[model samples]
Each structure stands twice: as structure tokens, then as C-alpha cells.
Target: MKTFTLLQEVVHIPTKKKGQVITTKVDREGKQMVEVKYENGTTGWSIPEALTNFIQDSVDHTGEFLSD
Candidate 1:
């Protein structure tokens, strides 16, 4: 588990279905990225202030999640 912030922007478009959303974030490297969150609580992306800079696929129950 890690800590990060989310910007109110869409790096990419996501499904309008429940629990599926795409957001834009500035990672720890200061790179703007697109993140897609799924209904199952899994996610795909890089978030602000994260340790890694790659899109990851994992469940994130925490309100705050960082992609690997």
C-alpha cells in the first residue's frame, strides 16, 4: 500500500459503468498519466506520488492507491 493524490482530470476516457472511471494524475516523477479503475476494486495506472511509473492491475480497496 502507498499514498498518492488524484487530479480532477481525465487522462483517458473510461467506461461509464458503475465503478469504472478514468482519471489523470501527476506521478512522483511528475509525469501526467491516465488511470482506469474497475468495479472489482482493481485498477490500471500510475498515480501521483507513487513509487513506480507503470500501469498496474490489482485490487485497491483503499481510497488511496498507487500503481506499480
Candidate 2:
């Protein structure tokens, strides 16, 4: 079976009031997929390529964190 490793990062979402949690996923090819879930159980997906930058940044941060 062909297997692909999944990478994930948690990002802060600006909410109407405060404290919103958003999840983002990045594939090996730099494709970004996002999911946002509301307290009411509503959810949505976004395909903004802007997430690639965030994914890279997070990966760098993780490496730094692990090295320390």
C-alpha cells in the first residue's frame, strides 16, 4: 500500500470575541487544506495557498523546538 505521512499544525483563529481554534494540514506537495469548526458544530474548508508559508514556518519552529 502507498503511504503518505500527514503533517498538521494548529493555528489561532481571530474570533468575534476571542479564543478560536483552527486546524491546518499541508501535504508533501505544499498543498494546503484548512478546517475551521465553530462551537455550534459548523465547519468549513479553505484552500488558500497562503497556508504554505505558515506550514513552513511551523515546521521550522518544530525543528528548533526539537533541537533544543
TM-score between model 1 and native = 0.27
lDDT of each: 0.44, 0.42
Candidate 1, 26-55: lDDT as tens digits: 678767755656556667774333333223
Candidate 2 residue spans exceeding 4 A from truth: 1-21, 49-68
lDDT of 2 at 11: 32
| Clash totals, every prediction | 0, 0
Superposition TM-score, candidate 2 onto the true structure:
0.30
Q: Tell me, what's the RMSD of every candidate?
A: 12.6, 9.2
Judged by whole-model lDDT over C-alpha atoms, candidate 1 comes out at: 0.44
TM-score per model over all chains: 0.27, 0.30
> For residues 1-68, could you state the per-residue lDDT of candidate 2 as single tens digits?
11112334323233332112365677678776566444455665545432232344445443334453
